[model samples]
Target chain A: MNKILKSIYMPILAVIIAIIIGSIIMLVTGFNPLAAYASLFIGAFGTLPNIANTLANAVPLIITGLGVAIAFNAGLFNIGAEGQYWIGAIVATWIGYSFKGLPWYIHIPFALIGAMVAAGLWGGIVPGFAKAYTGAHEVITTMMMSYVAIYFSHYLLEFGPMMEKGSVPQSPLIKDSAIIPTILRNTQLSYGIFIAIAAALFVYWLMYKTVWGYEMRAVGFNQRASKYAGMNVPLNIVLSLSLSGIFAGLAGAVQILGVQHRLYDSFTSGYGYTAIVVALLAKNNPIGVVFSALLFAALGTGSQYMQLNAQVPGQLADVITGLIIFFVAADKIIEVLKSMFKKQKKEELAS
Target chain B: MKEILLNPQLWSATLAMATPLALPALGGTFSERSGVVNIAMEGIMLIAAFFAVLFAHLTGSAWLGLLGAIVVGMIVAVIFAWAAVTLTADQVILGMAINIFASGFTAYLLNTIFGFSGTPTDTPMLPNINIPVIKNIPFIGQILSGNSVIVYLMIILIFASNYFLFHTNLGLRIRAVGENPEAAETAGINVIKLRYLGVALSGLFSAIGGAYLSIGLLNSFSTDMSSGRGYIALAAMIFGKWTPFGSFGAALLFGFATALSMQLQNSAMSKNIIMMLPYILTVLALVGVGGKSVSPAADGVPYTPKK
Candidate 1:
C-alpha cells in the first residue's frame, strides 16, 4: 500500500498544483476559473458520450505513453515518438487504402506489422545503430528524424503518390474492412482501447517477467556495471529503442485503424510529445500510464467545451499540461515543501 | 539551375534564414559548454517571439519590443536555470516542459490579445538596413547590403562569442566547470554562477532568434511561427562541434538548403518534398559528424557542492 501510495502521491500533487496555478493565470487574465473548470469537468464526463469520447481520446496517449515509458526503463529518451508514429501512420494508411481484397483480420494485422517494421526501422534502427556504433545522441537524431517524417507525410498526402483524386490534399479513405470496429455504433470509442490496454499489459510483462527486460533495466541503471556483467549494452540500447519505436508505430497504426480512418494532411494531435509528460507523470510505469493518459485525455476532451462555455481558449489544456510537466520535473521543490510543513507541525506541537 | 544559382536573392535568403538558426545555435554553445544541455532554445525563441510582437505593439517601437523580449527571455532562462541547476532536475525534461509551456502560453496569449485575426498589422518591425557603400558593390553588395539589422548583429555576435568563449579567462573557467565541476569548485571557481550565466546567455541569443522570426523577418506573430528553427539550430550546434564559428557555418549550410528549397518552389518538383531538405540534411549531418564531436564531461550532470 505504501509503495503504491508513494508512486501515486507525486503525480497527484503535481496535477493539483498545476491546476491551481492554471486557475491563478485565468484569474489574473480576468476570467472565471470556476466556470471554466466546471464546464471542463462536465465536458469530460457529464454524459455517456462525453465519457466515451474521453476514453477514446486516451487510447493513443496510452499507447504512446507506454512506448515512452519503456524507453525510459532502458534509460533511453525516445523523443521522436512523433516521427516514428508519423511514419507508421503513413504506412498504415497506405496499406489500409491500397490493399484490395484482404479481410479485416488479415488486413489489419498486416498493416500493423508492416507499419511497426517500417517505423521501427526509421525511428529505431537508424538512431539506435547510430548511437550504439558512433556515440551519436539519440535525442538529436530522433528529433531530426521526426521532422523528416513529418515533412515526408505532408509530401505524401499533399502532392506525392499517396494523394487521392480530389483537389484537397487528403488521402483516400481506408477501406471498410480495414476499420477497427467501434464498441458501440455511432460512438467514438473503439476496440483500439483494448489494444492500448493490451499493449500496457504486454509492456508490464516485458519489463518485469522477462530476462530481456531485466537486462535492459540493468543497462539503464548502470551501463558500465551491465557491461561488466557481460550484458550486451549496445545491443540492449538498440533493442530498447527499437521496441519503443514499435510501440510508437503501434500507436499510429491503432489511431489510423480505429479513430481517424484516413490520414489528414500533417495530422499531429501532439500525442507524441504529450506522451513524454504522461510517462513522466506515471513515473515510467506501464500501469500508471493508463491513468495518466486518461487524465490528460480528459483535459484534452474537455478543453473544447470549456472554450465554448467559459470563453477560454482550448490552448489552456496545453498550458495546464506544460505546468504539470514543470511541477513534475522540479519535484524536489515539492519534497522541500513537504518537509518544511512537517517541521512546522513539529514546532506547533511543541508550542 | 543556372537562373537559381545566379539570383542574389537566394544568397540573401540563405543569410536571412541562417540568422535565426545561428543565434540559437550560438546560444546553445554557451549553455552546453557550461555543462547544461539546453534544448530549451526552441521554447525561448518561441516565447521571445511572442513577447517581442506584444511589446512592440504596445510601445510602437520594434527596438523597445526587442528589449522587452530580451528581459522576458532572460527571466525564463532564470526559471529554467533554477530547475536545471539549482534544483538539479533533469535538464532534458525541464527543457521539454519549457518548450511546451512556451507553445501553449504563446498560443493562448496570441488568441487572447490578438484575437483570431492575428497580431496588429501596423505592429513595428526592425528595419532592413542598406549599407551605403556596400550597396554599390556588384553581386556581393546585393547579398550583404539589404537585410534585417539582426542579420548583421548575428554575424557580429558569432565573432564576439568566439573571442569570449575561446580567448578569455571567463571562457576557460566556464569550460573547466563544465568538464569538471568538482575540480573547478576545488579551485574556488563558482560553478553555479557560471552555469547560470551560460544559460542566461542562451536565453538572450534564442530571444534574438525568436524575434528575428516574428519581427525581424515577418511583421506578425503566428502560432508556432518559429516552427522548428530552434531544433534546426540545435542540429547546427552539434554539427558545428559546439563552437560558435562551427555552429555558424552549419547554420549557413542549413540556411542554404532552405534557400535552395525556396528557390525550387517555382519548379515542377513538389513543394512538400522540398520542405524536407533541411531536416534530412540535419539527420545526415549528425550521422556523418555528430559521432566525432564529444560533449564536455559532466555536461548533463547536476552538481551538488559537498559541504
Candidate 2:
C-alpha cells in the first residue's frame, strides 16, 4: 500500500506544481489567474453542453490512452497509436459509409469492430518481427509503422477508390443510419462515450482478471524468464500488440461516428500521439487512463475558451501539456520524491 | 535510355530533394553511432526551419539565415542533451516531448511574432549560388553546381564525417563510448561528455538540413513543416545500420522515394498515385531492411555511473 502511495505521490505533487506555475505565469502576463481558471473551470463544466463537449473529446482520448497504456504495460512503447488510431478511424468510416441497410445497433458495432480488427492487424505486423527476430525492438518498428499508417491513410483518402472523386483528399460521408447517436440534444457528445467507458472496464478486467493477462505481465516483466517458464513469449507479444491496437482503433471509430461523421485525411490530428502522454500520466492504469483523458480533454477543450477570452493562443495548451509531460518524464523527479519523503519524515518527528 | 541519360532536370531535382535528407541522415548516423538515439532531429530541424526563415526575413540574406539555423539547432540539441544525459530521462520520451514542444512552441511563436497561425513571416528565401566553372559543365553542372550552399556543405560533410569517424582519435573515442561505455570508461574516457558531443554534433548537422528545407528549399516555414523527415532520417539511420556511408545510401533512397512522389505529382499522367509513392516505397524499404538494422550498443539506455 505504501509502495503504491509512493509511486503516485510525485505525479500528484507535479500536478499541483504545474497549476501553481500556470497561474503565476498567467498573472505575470497581466491576466487574473483566478478569473482565467474560473472561466476555464466553468467553461469546461459550467453547463451540460460544456460537460458534453468535454466528454465528447475525452471519449476518443480515453480509448487511445488505454491503447497506449496496454502497450506500455506490456513493455512495448506503441508510438504507432496515432497511426493505429488513424487506420482504425479510416476503417470504421469505410465500414460505416459502405454498408447501407444495417440497423443502427448492428451497424455501429460492426463499424467499430472493423476498425479494431484493421488497427489490430496493423499493430500485429510490428510485433511479428520483434517476436521472430532475436533482437527486434518494437519501439523503432512502431515509430516507423506510425508514419506508414499515417501516410497510407492519407494516400487512401487522396487517390484510392474509397476517396470521393474531385474532392481534395477526403472520403465520402457515411449514411446517417451508420452514425452513432448523440446522447445529448444539439451536442456532438455521442453514445461513443459509453463505448469508451466499456472499453476501459473491459481492459481493466482483461489486465487484472485473465490468465492471458497474467502471462502477458509475466512476459513483459521478463521475456527470458517467461520463455524459460514455458510461456509462449512470441504469442503474448503479438497478442498484447493486437490488443493495444484495438484500443487505438476504437478511439478512431469513436471520432468518426461521434464527431466528424466522415473520413478525412489527418482528421484525428494528434490524439494518438497525445494518448501516449495520457497513458504515461495515468501510469498505465485503466481508471487512471480515464481521468488523464479527461484532464487532456479539458485542456484541449478549455484552450478554445482561453483563445477567445484571454488572447493566449490555443497552442498554449499544447505547450503546457508538453511541459507537464517533460517534467513528469524527466525521471529526475525521483530526487524530488526523495526530498519530499525526507521532509515528511522531519515533519513527523517534529510533531 | 537516351532520354533518361539526357535528363539534367531530373538529376538536379533528385539532388535537391536528396541533399536535405542526406545531411540529416548522416547527422543521425553520428549520433546513433555514439550510442544516442537522436529522434529530436525533427524538432531541431523544425526550429532551424523557423529560425532559418526568421533570420532570412530579418536580414534579407540567406547566409545569415543558414547561420541562424545552425545556432538555434545547437541550442535545442543542448536542451535534448541536458534532459537525456544529465537528467537521465528516457531518450525516446524526451525525443517525443521535444517534437511536441517544437510543434506547439513554433505555432505559438508564429502567432506571437508574426501574428499568423500557419506560416511564419514570409520574406525572400535563400537563393541558389551558382558555381562559375561547375555551372558550365553539361549534366554534372545542372545536377550539382547551382544549389544552396548547405547542399555543398552536405557533400563536404559526408566526406568529412567519414574521415572523422575512421581517421580521428576523438572520433575513435566517441565510437568506443557507444560500443561499450564501461570499456571506454576503463580506458579513461568521459563517456557522458562524448555522447553529448555526438548528439550535439548531430543537431548541428540536422539544423543545416532543416535550414536547407526552409531557406534553401521551401523558403518559408509552415506549421508542422518538418513533417516526419527527422523520423525518416532515424529510419534511414537504422536501415543503414548506423554507418555514415550506409545511412548516406539510405538517405539517397528515401530522398529518391520523396523526389519520385513529387515528380509524379507534377507529371500529368501519374498525379493520381503520386501521394502513395513515398509511403509505398518507405514500407518496401522497411520490409527489405527488416531486422537487419543495428544500433550502437548503448543507444536509448542512459549511461549512469554505478554507485
Candidate 3:
C-alpha cells in the first residue's frame, strides 16, 4: 500500500502544481482563471457527452503512452511514435478502403493487424537495425524518420492512391466493416478504449511477468552486465522497440477506425508527440499512463469550451500541458525539498 | 536539373537558405562541444523568431528586434542550463519540454498580442546589404553579395568560431571540460562557468538564426515559421562531426538541396516529391555517416565534482 501510494504521490503533486502554474499564466494573460478552470472542468466531465469526448480523445494517448513507456523501460527513446502512428494509420486506411463485402470481424482485424506490422517495422526494425549494427543514435534516426513519414504521408494523401476523387487532400471513407463501433450513442467514444485498457494490462504483464521482460530490463539497467550474463543485447533492443511500435501503431489504427474513419494529411493531430508527455507524467508506468492520458485528454477537450465560453485562447491548453511537463521534468526540485524536510524533522525528533 | 544546377541564382538562394541552418549548427557545435546536448535549439529558434518580430514591430527597429531575440534566447537557455546543468535533470526530457513550451507559448502570444491566427504583415524586415564593388563583380559576387546582413555575419561567424574553438585558450578549456570535466576541474578550470558560456553562445547563435528566418528570409513572422530547420541544423551538426567548418559544409549541402527543390517547383515533377528531398537527404546523411561521426567524449553526461 505504501509503495502504491509512493508511486501515485509525485504525479498527483505534479498535476496540481502544473494546474496552479497554468492558472497563473491565464491570469497574467488577462483571462479569468477561475472561470476558465471551472468551464474547463465542466466541458470535460459535466455531461455524459463531454465525458465521452474526453475518453475518445484519451484512447490514442493511452495507447501511445504505453508505447513510449515500454520503450523507456528498455532504455530506448522511441521518439518516432509520430511517424509510426502515421504509417499505421496509412496502412489501416489503405486496407480499410480497398476491401469490399467482407465480414466486420475479419476485415477490421486484418486492417488493424496490418497497421501494427507496418508501423512496427517502421518504428522498430529500421531504427533498431541502425542503432544495433551501425551505432547510429536512435534519437536522431527516429526523429529524422518522422519527417520522412510525415512527408511521405502527405505525398500519399495528396497525390497517390489514397486521394479522394475530389480536390480535397484526403482519403475516401473506410468501408463500414472496418469501422470500430461507437459505444456512446451520441458521442465519438468507441470500443477502442477497452482495447487500450486491455493493451495496458498486457504491457503490465509483459513487463512484470515475462522472462523476455526481465532480459529487456536487465539490458536497460546495464548493457554490459546483461551481455556478460549471456543475454542477447542487440536482440532485446530490437524486440523492445518493436513492441513499442506495436502499441503506437495500434493507437493510429484505433484512432482512424474509431474516430476519423478516413485518412488525411497530418491527421494524427500530434498525438505521438503529446504521448511523450503522457509517458513522462506517468513515470513510464503502463498502468499509470491510462490516468495521465485521461488528464491530458480532459485538458484538451476542455480547452475548446474554454475558448468559446471563457473567451480564452484554445492554445492555453497546450501552454498548460507544456508547463506540466516542465515542472514534472524538473522533479528533482521537489525531491530535494522533500529530503530536506525529512532531515529537519528527524533532527527535531532526536533533539 | 542541369539548368537548375547551372543557374548562378541558385547559389545565392542556397547561401540564403544555408545561412539560417549554419548559425544554429555552429551553435549546436559549441553547446555539444561543452558536453551539453541541446535538442532545444528548435524551441529556442521558434521563441526568438516570434519575439524578434514582436519587438521589431513594437519598437520599429530591426536591430532592437534582433537584440531582443538574443536576450530572450539567452534567458531561455539559462532556464535550460539551470535544469540540465545545475539540477542535473535529464537533458533530453528538459529539451523536449522547452520545445513544447516554446511552441505553445508563442502561439498563445500570437493570439493575445496580435489578435489573429495568421502571420503579421505590417512588421518591418531587415534590409539587404549589397556590397557595392562585390555586387558588380560577376558570378562569384552574385553568390556572395546582396543578401541580408545576417547572411554575411553567419559566414564571418563560421570562421570566427573555427578560430575561437581551435586556437584560443578559452576554447581549450571548454574542450577540456567537455572531454573530461574532472580533469578540467583538477586543472583549475571553472567547468560550470565554461559550460554556461558555451550554452549561452549556443542560444545567441540560434536566436540569430531565428531572427534571420523572420526578418531575413521572410518579411514577417508566421506560426511555426522555423519549421524543422532547427532539427536539420542538429543533423548537420552531427553529420559535420561536431566541427564548425564541417557543420557549415553540411548546412550548405542541405541548403543547396532545398534550393534545388525550389528551382524544380516549375518542373513537371510533383511538388510533394520535390519537398521531400531535403528530409530524405538528412536521413541518408545520418545513415551514411553512421559510426563515423564521434561526439564529444562526455557529451550529454552531467558533471559533478568529486566530494
Candidate 4:
C-alpha cells in the first residue's frame, strides 16, 4: 500500500502544479481561467456522451503509452510509435479494403494481426536490429524510420494502390465486417476501449510475471552485468522494441478499425509523441499509463469546448499538456522541496 | 538527368535550400561537442521563426525581427540549460517537452495575437544582397550571388566554426569537457559554464536559421514552416560525424536531394513519390553512415560536480 501510494504521489502533485501554472498562463493571456477551466471540466464530464468521447480519445493513448512504457523499461527510447501507428493503419487499411464477404470475426482479427505484424517488423525489428548489430542509436534511427513510415504511408494513400477515387488523400472505407462496434450512441466511443484495457493488463503481466520480462529488466538495469549473467542482451533489445511496436501498431489498428474506419493522411495526429509524455507521467508503469492517458484525453476532449465557449484556442490544451510534461520531467524539484521541509521540521523539533 | 545535374539553377536552388539546414547543423556541432545533446533545436527554430515574423510585422524592421528571434531563442535555451544542467533531468525528455511547448505556445500565440492560424502577408522581408562584381561573374555568380545576407553568413559561419572548434583555446576546453568532464574539472575548467555557453550559442545559430526561413527565404511565417528541417539538420550533424564542415557537406547533400525532388515534380511521375526523395535519402544516409560516426564520450550524460 505504501509503495502504491508512493508511486502515485508525485504524478498527482505534478498535475496539480501544472493546472495551477496553466491557469496562470490563461490569466496572463487575458482569458478567464476559472470559467475556461470550469467549462473544460464540464465539457469533458458533463454528460455521458462527453465521458464516452473522452474515453474513446483515450483508447489509442493508453495503448501507445503502454508501448512507450514497455520500451522505456528495457532502456530504449522508442520515438517511432508514430511510424508504427502509421504502418499499422496502412496495413490494416489494405486488409480491410481488399477482403470481402468474410465474417466479422475473421476479417477484423486478420486486419488487426496484419497491422501488428507489419508495423512490428518495420518500426520495431528493423531499428532493433540496427541498434543490436551495428551499434546505431535508437533515438536517431527511430526518428529517421518514422519519416520513412510517414512518407511511405503518404505515398500509398495519395498516389499508390490505396488511393480513393477522389482527390482526397485517403483510402476507401473499410468493409463493415472490419469495423469495431460502437459502444455508445451519439458518440465516437467504441468497444476498442475494452481491447485497450485488456492489452494494458497483458502488458502488466508480461513486464512483471514473465521470464523474458525479467531478462529484459535485468538488461535494462545493467547491460554488461546481464551479458555477464548469460542473458542475450541483443536479443532482449530486439524483443523489447518488437513488443513496443506491437502495442503501437495495435493503437493504429484500433484507431482505424474502431474509429476512423479508413486510412487518411496525417491521421495519427501526434498520438505517438504524446505517448512519450504519458509514459513519463506514469513513470513507465503500464497500469499508471491508463490513468494518465485518461487525464490527457479529458484535456483533449474539453479543449474544443473551451475554444468555442470561452474564446480560448484549442491549442491551449496542448500548452497545458506540455506544461504537465515539463513539470513531471523536473520531478526532482518536488523531491528537493520535500527533503527541505523535512530538514526544517527536524530543526524545529531540535529548537 | 544530364541537364539536371549540370544546371547552375539547380545548384543555386540546392545551395539556397542548404543554408537553413547548415546553420542549425553547425550549431548542433558546438552543442554536441560540448557534451550537451541539443534535440530541442526543432522547438527552438519554431519559436524563433514565429517571433521573427511577429517582430518584423510589429516594428517593420527585418533586422530587428532577427534580433528578437535571437533573444527569444536564447531565453528558451536558458530554460533548457537550467533543466538539463541544473536539475540534471533526462535531456532527451526535456528536449521533447520543450519542442512540444514551443509548438503549442507558438500556435496559441498566433491564434490570440494575429486572430488567425497563419501569419498575415505584408510582413516585411529581408532583402537579398547582390554582390555587385561577383554577381556579374557567370555560373559561379549564379550559385553564390543575389541570395539573402543570411546565406552569406552561413558560409562564413562554417569556416568560423571550424576554426573555433579546432584552433581556439575555448574550443579546446569545450572539447575537453565533452571528452571527459572530470578531467576538465581537474584542469580548472568550469564545465558547467562552458556547457551553458555551448548550448546558448547553438540556440543563437538555430534562431538565425529560423529567421532566415521566416523573413529571408519567405516573406512571412506559416504554421510549422520549419517542417522537419531541424530534424534533418540533426541527421546531417550525425552524418557529418559531428564536424562543422562534415555537417555542411551532409546538409548540401540533403539539399541537393530536395532540389532533385523539386525538379522531378514537373515530370509525369507522381509528386508524392518525388517528394519522398529527401526523407528516403536521410534514412539511407543514417543507415549507412550512423554507425561509423562516433559521438563525444560523455555526450548526453549530466555532470554532477563531486563534492
Candidate 5:
C-alpha cells in the first residue's frame, strides 16, 4: 500500500505544480487565468460530447503510451514508436485496400495482424539488430528509422504505388469491410477505444503475469547478472524492442482502419513525444496509462477551446506538459525534499 | 553525376550547409565527451534562433542578436546542466522535454508578439566575409572563402576545439572525468564542475549554430527553422567518431548529400526519394556502413557522487 501511494503521489504533485505554474504564466502574460482555465475545464469534461471527444482523442495516446511503457519497463528508451506507427499505418492501408469481397471480420483481423507483425519485425530488424550486433545506440538508430519511415510514406502517397489518382497526395480509402464502426454518433469517437483499452489490459498481463516478462525485467535490472544467470540478454533486448514496436504498430493500424480510413501524404502520428510523457506520468504502469493518457488528451482538447474562447494559445498546454516532465524527471529532488521535511518534523517532535 | 560533382556551387553550398551541422556536431562532441547525453540541441537551437531574430529585429544589429542568443543558450545550458548533473535526471528525457517545451514556447511567443506576420523582413543579417588572399584562387576560393561569416567562425572554432580538446590539461581532465568519474573524484578532480564546463561549451556553440540559421544564413526566423539539423549533427558526431575535425568532415559529406539532393530536384528521379539519402545514410552509418562508432566510457550515465 505504501509503495503504491509513493508512486501515485509524486505524479499528482507534479501535475498540480505544473498547472499552478501554467496559471502564473497566463497571469503574467495579461490573460485572465480563471476564464482560460474555466473554458479549458468545460471544453475537456463539461458535456457528454466533450467527454466523448476527449476519450476519442485519447485512443491513440493510450495505445502509444502503453507501447512506450512496455519499452520503459525493460529499461529501453524507445523513442522510435513514431516510426513504428507509420509503418503499421501504411501496412494496414495496403492490406485494407488491396483485398476485396471479404467479410469484415476476416479482413479487419488480417490487416491488423499483418501490420503488427511487420512493424514488430521492423523494430527488431533495424534498431534491435543494430544495437545487438554492433552496439549502436537505439536512440539514434530508431530516430533515423522514423525519418526513413515517414519519408517512405511521403514517397508512397505522393507518387508511389499507394497514391490515389488525385491532386491531393493520399491513398485510396479502405474498403467498407475493413472500416471500424463509430461508437458515438456524430463524433470522432470510434470503436477503436475498446481495442486501446484491451491493449492496456493485455500489456498488464504480459508484463506481470508471464515468465517472459520476468526474464525481460531481470535483464532490464542488470544485464550482466541476467546473462550470468543464463538469460539470453541480447534476445531479451530484441524482444523488448520488438514488443514496443508491436503496440505502436497497433496504434497505427487502428487509426487507419477506424479513424483515418485511408493513408495521406505527410502522415505522422505526432503522438510520439506525448506518449512518452504519458508513460512517464503513469510510471510505466499499464493500467495507469489509461488515466495518464486521458489527462494529456484532456489538456490537448481543453487547450484548443481555451485558444478559441479565451484567446489563449493552445500551445500553453505543451508548455505545461514540459513543466510536468521537468518535475517528474527530477523525482529524486522531490524525494530529497520529502526527506528534509520528515527530518524537520521529527526534530520538532523531539524538541 | 560528373557535372554535378564539378559544379562550384555544389561545393560552396556544401560549405554553407555544413556550418550549421558542424557547429552543433562540435557541441555534441563536447557534451558527450563529458558523459552527458544532450539530445536537446534541437531545442537549444530553436530557442536561440527565435531570440536571435527577436534581438536583431529590436536592435537592428546582427551581432547583438548573436550575443543575445548566446546568453539565452548559456542560461538554458545551465538549467540542463543543473538537471542532468545536480539532479542526476535522465539526460535524454530532459533533452526531449526541453525540445518539446522550446517548440511550443517559441511558437506561442511568435503568435503572441508578432501576430503571425512572422519576423520582420528587414532583420539585419550577418555579412559574408570575402577572404582577400583566397579570392584570387580559382575554384578553391569560391569553395573556401566568401561564405557566411559564421562559416568562417565555425572553421576557426573547429581548429580551436581540436587543439583545446587534445593539447590542454583542462581538456585532458574533462576526458578523464567522463571516462571514470569516481577515479577522477578520488584524484582530487571536481567531476561535477568539469561536466558543467563541458556542457556549457555545448550551449555556447549550439547558440552560434542557431544564431547562424536565423541571422547568419537567413535574415529572419521561422517556426522550427533548425529543421532537424541538430539531429543531423548528432549523426555527424557519430560518423566523425566524436572529434572536431572528424565531425567537420562528416558534416561536409552529409551537406554534400543535401546539396546534391537540391541539385537533383529538377531531374526525373523522385525528389522525395533523393531527400531520404541523408536519413538512410545515417542509419547505414550507425550499422557500421561508415565504421564502428564509439562513445565516451560514461556517456549518458548520470553521475551521483557516492555519499
Candidate 6:
C-alpha cells in the first residue's frame, strides 16, 4: 500500500514540476502561462467534442504505452514500439484496402489480427536475435528496427503496389465495412477507445494474474535465479517482447480503422516514441498507463488550440512533455524534491 | 571497366559517402570498447548538424561551423555521458530521449530562427577544395583529391584511432575499463575519466559526421537531416563488434545501400523496391551479424566506484 502511494505520488509530482517549468518558459516567451494552462484545461474538457478528441488521441497512446510498459517490466528495453506500430498500421492498411471484406465484424478483426501478427514478428525478431545469438542489446536493435519500420512504412505507402495510384504518398482508403464507428457525433473518437481500455484491463490481468506473467516477472527480477528455478528466461523475454509488439500493433490498427480511415506515409507521427515517456511516467503499470496516456493526450490535443490561439509554436507541448520525462527519469531530482518538501514541513512545524 | 575503375570522381564520391559513417563508427568503437553504449550518436550528429549550419551561416566560414558543431557536440555528448555514467539512467532510454529532444528542438529552432521548418537559409554552402597536385594525379588522386579537409581528417583519424586503440596504453586502458571497470580501477585507472574521454571522442566523431552531412554532402542544413544514420552507425558499431576497420566495413555496406537507393530513385529501374533496400539490408544485417558477434562485457553498465 505504501509502495502504491509512492508510485502515485512520484508521477503526480513530476507533472507539477513540468507545469511549473512550462509556466516559466511561457513567461519568458511573453505569454501568460496561466492563460495557456487555462486554455489547455478548457480544450481538454470544454465540450463533448473536446473530450472526444482528447480520448481519440489517448487511445493509441494508451495502447503503445502499455506495450512499452510490458517490455520494460520484463527488463527488456523495447524501443522498437515505433517500428512495431508502423508495421502494424502497414499490415492493417494492406488488409483494409486490398481485401474485399464480408461483414464489418470479420473485416475489422482480420485487419486487427493482421496488424498484431506483423508487429509481433517485428518485435519478436530482436529478442530472438538477443537470446539466440551474441546477447546483443535489445535497445540498439529496437532503435534500429524503429528506423527500418519507419522507412519501410513510408516506402510501402508511397512506392509500393499498395500506394493509391493518384496520391503522392498515401494508401487507398479502407473499405467502409472495416471502419471502426465513431463514438461521439462529431469527433474522431471511436470504438478503438473501448478497445484500448479493454486491452489495458486484459494486459493487467496477464501481468498480475497469470502463470506466464509470473514466469516473465520472475525473469525480470533475476534472470540467473529464474534460470536456476527452471524457467526458460530467453523464451519469456521473447514472449514479453512479442506481447508488447501486439499492443503496439493494436495502436496502429486503431489509428487507421478508427481515426484516419486511410493510411498515409508517416501517419502515426512519433506516437510510439511519445508513448515511451507515457509508460515511464506511469511506472509501467497498466492502470497508470491509462491516466498517463490521457494526460499526454491532453497535452498533444491541446497543442492544436495553443497553436491556433497563441504565437507560440505547438512544439511547446513536446518541450514540456520531454522535460517531464527527463525530470521523472532523474531519480535524483525526485529525491531532492522529497527532501525539500520534508524541510519545508519541518520549518512550518517550527514556526 | 578500366575507365570505371580509373574514375576519380567515382572513388571520391564513394569515399565521401563512406567517411561520414566511418568517423562516427570509429568514435562509437571507443565508447563500446570502454563498455559504454553511445546510441545517442544520432542525436549528437543532429545537434552538430544544426550548429554547423547555424555557425557557418553566422560566421560565413565552414571551418567555424565545424568548430562550433564540435563544441556543441561535446556538450550534447557530455549530457549523454552524464546521464548514463553519473546518473546511471537507462542508456537506451536516455538515447531515445535525446534523439526525440533533438528532433523537436531542431524543429523549434528552425521555426524560431528562420520561420520555416523544412530547410533553413538558402545562403552560401560549403565549397569543395581542389588540391593542386592531388587533383592532377591518377585514379587514386582523383578519388582523394577534391573533397573537403574534413574527409582527409577522417582518413587520418581512422588510422590514428586504429593505432590508438590497438597500440596505445590509453587504448588498452579504455578496453580494460569496458571489459571490467572494477578490475581496471583496482589497477589504478580512473574509470570515470576514461569513460568521459571515450564519450567525448564519440561526440567529436559524431560532429564530424554531422558536418559531412550538412557541409560535405548536402551543402546546407535541413530539418531532421541526419535521419537515421546515427542508428545505422550504431548498427555498424555492433556489426563491427567494436573494431574500427570492422565498423568501417559495416558503414560502407550502409553507404552502398544508401548510394544505391538514391541512384535507383534517379534511374528508370525498379525504383520502388530499390529505395527500400537500405532498411531491408539493415534488418538482414541485424539478424545476420547480431547472431555471431560478442560485445564488451561491461557494455551499458554504468561504472560506479566503490564507496
Please, what is the TM-score per model?
Answer: 0.97, 0.91, 0.95, 0.95, 0.95, 0.91
Report RMSD (Å) for each prediction in the order shown.
2.0, 3.7, 2.8, 2.5, 2.5, 3.4
lDDT by residue for model 5 over B85-119, one digit each (tens)? 99899998888888878877887888777767888
- Give the CAPRI rating of model 6: acceptable
Give candidate 5's error at residue B176 in angstroms: 1.1
What does candidate 3's lDDT look like per residue over B252-275, in tens digits?
988887787778665423655665
Cα lDDT of model 4 by residue, A36-76, tens digit: 99889888888999999999999999998998888899999
Model 4 chain B weakest lDDT span, ten residues long: B266-275
Tens-digit lDDT track of model 3 for A1-351: 999899888778877887888888887888889999999999999899999999999999999999888888888888889888988899999999999999999999999899999988988877887777766678887887777788778778775768899878899999999999999998999999999999999999998899998888888889999999999989988888888888888999999999999987863468998999999999888899999999999999998988889888878888778777877878887877889999999999999
Clashing pairs in 4: none
lDDT of 1 by residue, B247-276 (tens): 999899888888888787754235556666
Each candidate's interface RMSD (Å, one decimal) is 1.7, 3.3, 2.0, 2.1, 1.8, 3.0
Off by over 4 Å in 2: A1-5, A16-39, A131-134, A165-168, A333-351, B1-7, B58-61, B117-124, B266-291
**Residue B167 in candidate 1, Cα distance off native in Å:** 0.5
The TM-score that candidate 4 achieves is 0.95
Q: How accurate is candidate 1 locally (lDDT)?
A: 0.90
DockQ of each: 0.69, 0.40, 0.60, 0.56, 0.64, 0.35
Task: Give the Å shift of residue A78 in candidate 2.
Answer: 0.7
lDDT value, candidate 3, whole model: 0.86
Candidate 3: which stretches are off by over 4 Å?
A335-351, B117-120, B266-271, B274-291
Residue lDDT tens for model 2, B1-307: 3554467766677778777778788888778777888788988888898888888888888889889889999998988888888778888888887888787777767776677644544666766779999889887888878887777787888889989988999989988988898888888899889888988898998899898888888777887788888877777766677777877777777676665666556342244344334444444445554455556788777888553
In model 4, the number of clashes is 0
lDDT of each: 0.90, 0.79, 0.86, 0.87, 0.87, 0.80
| Candidate 2 RMSD computed on C-alpha atoms after optimal superposition onto the true structure | 3.7
The candidate that wins on lDDT is 1
Tens-digit per-residue lDDT, A33-53, candidate 1: 999999999999998899999
